[model samples]
Target chain A: MQIYLPIAEMSVSVLLILGMGMAVGFVSGLFGIGGGFLMTPLLIFLGIPPAVAVATQSAQIVASSTTSALAAWRRRALDVKLAGVLLIGGLMGTALGVWFFAAARRAGQLELVIVISYVTLFSVIGGLMLKESIKEFWSTRKGAVRPPRRGGQHPAYMRLPLRVRFYRSKIYVSALPVLGLSLSIGFAGAVLGIGGGFILVPALLYLFRVPTAVVVGTSQFQILWTTLAALVLHAVANQAVDAVLALLLIIGGVFGAQFGARAGRNLRADLFRLLLALLILAVGVRFAVELVVRPTEPFSLVVSEMRE
Target chain B: MRFGLALLLCLLAAGPAGAETLVASLSTSQVRITSNYTGSQIVVFGAIERDAQTVARAGPYQVVVTVRGPRQAVTVREKSRTGPVWINGPQQKFVQIPAYLGVFASAPIADIATPGQRGRLRIGLQASVNAPDITMDRGTEDDRFREALARLKIKELLFIEDERGTTFLTPSLFRTPVPLPVTAPPGDYEVDVTLFADGVLLARAGTSFEVIKTGFEQRLAEFSTEWAALYGLGTAAVALLFGWLATVIFRRD
Candidate 1:
């Protein structure tokens, strides 16, 4: 069935949109990722306007992240104190991100900026993940487990001020780096229409040396807030969010997430990481190709209200 | 027999002296874009009244109907390779361009009228709308952008021309269907029907129809424009509520 999206001023197949949401949600569930980066581009490819696609996916992220955050909280895995600090920076970062988004849209540069950022972000993150996961996979083949080290904290972080103690993660460090990291991530997430979990997870685990379990839970908790902030910002600032599109995606996402979470339990961690890393790298490369490649139709149209 | 003569006499009396009389009506006066609206078609039907002397002097008649949507500002951008990546290059900002334009004629437009006549009457798609104002440096490059804009709009089906789109039911009666695509913007649309014979405009009539958003669609558009902040906050709140509800219902022990 075709449904008219009022905000986007377009008609799209309900089944197609549902399928996209379900597929993205399934991947998100299996990987414990927000899936906004995947969903936004897919929506654009399916004919949703780029701005609307980017903004509307933020709402979907809020729902998905909230579900996972609540689950983590119930399991006593979430670091609430850490999430609180992250959100303080997150809100401030979202404000800056939204401003930049609105300005870029007016300048007719939003789409280009989004593509470039995605290309750069996905390549770097995917490359590192692929490298780390492959190392682990090969080590396992030798039938020996390596002793884990819990000492990856950067010495440079000690000089920062506003020291805070996080009981859940058992870390005593300056809040500055945490705030700065989340602020930058939040700004990038809002602009890219993601929860910043992909970046946040690695940053927390590798840079702060936070335990994997706490990192996962805290990342989800913080994503819930940042994506919510982005959703509200895009709506109010750009009026880009489509309620109908968001609703359709949520319906499919909820069901798909259940199946994905179930299937994820049977998958080996090393295999999952390898697959995710490849997927991320693939998306990044696609964007890079789009940038350098000559387009079939070089001209694009932008319709605006007549300003007399 | 007496009534027939009276009708003929009335027709002659109603038509302007030594000229044809054209009367037109649209199938609908308003197009409502509801939540389920995908696209719509409007039929324009009309009758031409002419005296025997005029009919004998002129050849078979041709009817041209045009439907023009509301005017709006637009920006068209062309991309070119800059360094390793392609980016926007020359840009044109048009003050006003019709969101939709459809031209339908009984026969091939070229056969119906001369190029001069076509330009004067703005008959075909190319001549119907004037080139929009360009903001950047005015030169031949701006004209290229203008043509590119028209081409892009044509590709989108927002601007169209169908030479044989109109059909004649009788020598004096004609009708045509003007299709409005799903992307057609909602606003006032003007429909013009012109009758021509021997490369001369015999008569013309004009009417308009409105395309409007209705029901929930209307309310949503209005709210988004009027109360953006509230709408945005509401969207976030509702999304959160939905997420919370899903968590409550779907949570496993």
Candidate 2:
């Protein structure tokens, strides 16, 4: 059951890796999240080198995002124009992210940055989701008049710049902020080896007032491109992408995605958000505890490039 | 014929009288690292070949066997809690740290030889690593860093030391088995067998083996290193293709 990963230079159990992929893929499908927030930590815990884990996880994200996004597209849930603009910004961010990643790696701070970013982002995002979902649940129970306009209702902000219409989401917003938002998301995705869907989905819903149905598809589209950029950058710059490990993950991920997308349709929005928030919080707390607790072994090792 | 005889006699006169000799061989010299290679076991068997000094003449024999992989540089860092978070603190850079090391001795390493002798021969973990390049002068801090490196390597199962790892079939013949984990770096590895008798060095023998990647695994590693840009493009293209294929095949109306 053990397989040797050439790039990672380690032997790992086949079933264990597959199971990890399936679990993460399922989450990806269920919530339209890239699942990197969970998968990257799990891979690191399983002894995969941090660089290889991050780079390889991006490949897996590419596969799962495609699977789920295609399904959404078939259902006419995607805002093609909006996703395209996001893709352009994402590519720009990817370039910057790759440069930053290389610098951090050379300084031996890549792992620390990854852990800190995950803890900070997950806690903030999770806290917001939890609060919002609780209020939404109560509002529905009380049958109160729901706010029809959320993100698109900002009249003053909408008046400031050249507006572009997103026909699918039924909004006229300035392309500048949309481009800026995607740049940040893309930067995060490349650097963190994530789809950035956790942030993207919520941003689309609250910031742009994108329809929930369109949000998932559009984020998936952006995720696919951003992760592809990350995959290429890591492979070229670090040579850390383990092809065998990525294949194993994709095998499990592709199958799990279908079932996840199907099941997601049956879940209530408030309940789904609550579950996602809890999951994110769990990961954040685990990271925070690791940072606070004294390590069993205070010493660590790194192989430096051999002098010629 | 007369010149040959004189030359032989001259060589013999210059050589030590009744010197004990050692001969060794590995079960296999080349370890082929295939795609499914998780690890490998190499059986190192050697014998103390006696010439003028018979087995009975010399004291009971002892053998110490060690296999060292290619040398490389490594950085060791220590982490300490800063406020609510743990961060890397002091760091040391060490050159000539072997990527892999396995030492097996028939008897306790301490019992085999004197500390000075061990250090001279680079026999054990403590004696093997060269002095690290520590910029700051902190007494005993260098030793602490070196020890930490050994401990961390041991925890990873990369560096191993077994006092009774070598088993003797006969008084002069011995065998030791070393398991090379998948994490073992691929390179030329030198195997050294030192023969000892009553804490006195008898003879020494050395041989080398290679751990190399083969087939697709070899080619892939090479391509990634040699033509990284192409490799990156290929990896991205393949991943994207696979994603597209999955989407198309699993498409639902």
Candidate 3:
């Protein structure tokens, strides 16, 4: 059950990697997120080089997101026009992210920046989700007035300069904040080497008041394309993609995604949000603890380049 | 690298080589890294051969075997806690140092050879790391950074030393095993077997082997670098294929 990864230059247990992939895939299907936020860190923890782990993970993300994204699309739950705008902003962010990533690396603070960003993103996003979901759960139990879902009840800040109508979400909101939201998401995604699905899903629901189900589909659609772009970039820049490893992950991931998507439909939206909020906070707390605890080994080695 | 070994062998043979000359062979000269390759061990079997001018010695002969993997540049970075978080501080780069180094001796290297002799011959782990070839990127060889590098490598199972790793089968014959960890990179590795008696170097012999990725692993690694874009597209296609298959099997809408 031991297999050697070609590009990563490491030997890993097949079953262990399969299990990790399946777990991420389940998250992908259930939440309509790429799950790269979890998968990348897990890969690095298993001793895969950071560069290789980041590059190779895109393939797994593509597989997981596509499985759920395509399903949502077939069910007519995805918003293509909205996702398209987000894609444009994401691409712009990717270019900026890569340049900044290189600069941070040159300063030898890339690891610090990545860890800090992870802690900050996870806590803020997870904290807000938990708070809102708890309130939503209680309000429903009391039979109180539900939060507004239809568009046009916009706050002053959301009423930006240019207005565009999204027919699917029934929103006549400005495109500026939407574009800006995606731009920042993309930048964060590139810096963290993740798909940004977790953040995207929540942002769509809170900011645009996108329907619960549609938010899943749209975020997944966006994740699929961004991960594909990332895969190609890593390939061209570092040639770090390990095809064999990715294939193993995909085999397990696709199976897990099927079951997870089915389970997602049966679960209530409030309960789903509660679980996701817990998961996100758990990951955040884990990283935070790592930062505080004294490391067993404080020195690490980085090879300059591979030699033939 | 092979030429360097050959030159070292010639110089050793031409040196004050007494009657006894070391002869050595390897269990495997080429390790093909297949899909199932985790790690492996290679044995060094050698004998002492003497010519007509052979003479009996007052003390028993001791053997020391050193196996070194290919040289590579590695940057060792140090991290110190800043408030609640530990952040990387100053770093040093080890230029063209052996990626893997293992020393196996019949007795403790220090017990068998004097510090001066060990340093001159690069016979032990300390001498190997502190050899004249080792150079840092910045500042002096502040013992702290170099020690940390050695310590980390040892923890990773890349740098090793076993005082009793070598054993003598008979008076003039011996054998030792060199272990290659899963992390061992594919490269050319050199094996040096030195004969010592009463803290004096007698004879030395050297051999080499290669660790290479063969069959599927080899081609995939090459394809990724040579046809980078195509490789990426191919992996993406496979993912898409799997994803589509999932949808078909679990169709529910």
* TM-score, per-candidate, Cα-based: 0.88, 0.90, 0.94
lDDT of 1 by residue, A76-157 (tens): 8789999998888887887799799999999977878987888899899889989998898888998879886555444778
Off by over 4 Å in 2: A95-116, A143-147, A150-152, A155-159, A190-193, A306-308, B1-18, B53-58, B130-140
The TM-score measured for candidate 2 stands at 0.90
Please state the error at residue A75 of candidate 3 in Å. 0.9
Instruction: Pick out the ten consecutive residues of candidate 3 chain B with the lowest summed lDDT.
Output: B6-15
Each candidate's DockQ score against the native complex?
Answer: 0.52, 0.53, 0.71
Best by lDDT: 3
Ranking by TM-score: 3, 2, 1
**Top TM-score hit:** 3
Tens digits of per-residue lDDT, candidate 2, A5-41, equal 8888777899999888888888888888888878887
lDDT of each: 0.79, 0.81, 0.85
Docking class of 3: medium
Where is model 1 more than 4 Å wrong at Cα? Answer: A95-115, A150-163, A170-172, A190-194, A261-267, A306-308, B1-18, B52-55, B129-137
lDDT of 3 by residue, A1-308 (tens): 89999778779999999998898888788988888778888898898988888888889888878888889889888889999999999888878888899999999789899989999999889999999999888999899987655545677746887887777766777888888888888898878877788888888888777878888888989989988888887898888889988998898898888778888989898898899898888888888988888888888888886555
Best-to-worst order by DockQ is: 3, 2, 1
Tens digits of per-residue lDDT for model 2 on B137-184? 444578778889899888878899999999999877889998898888
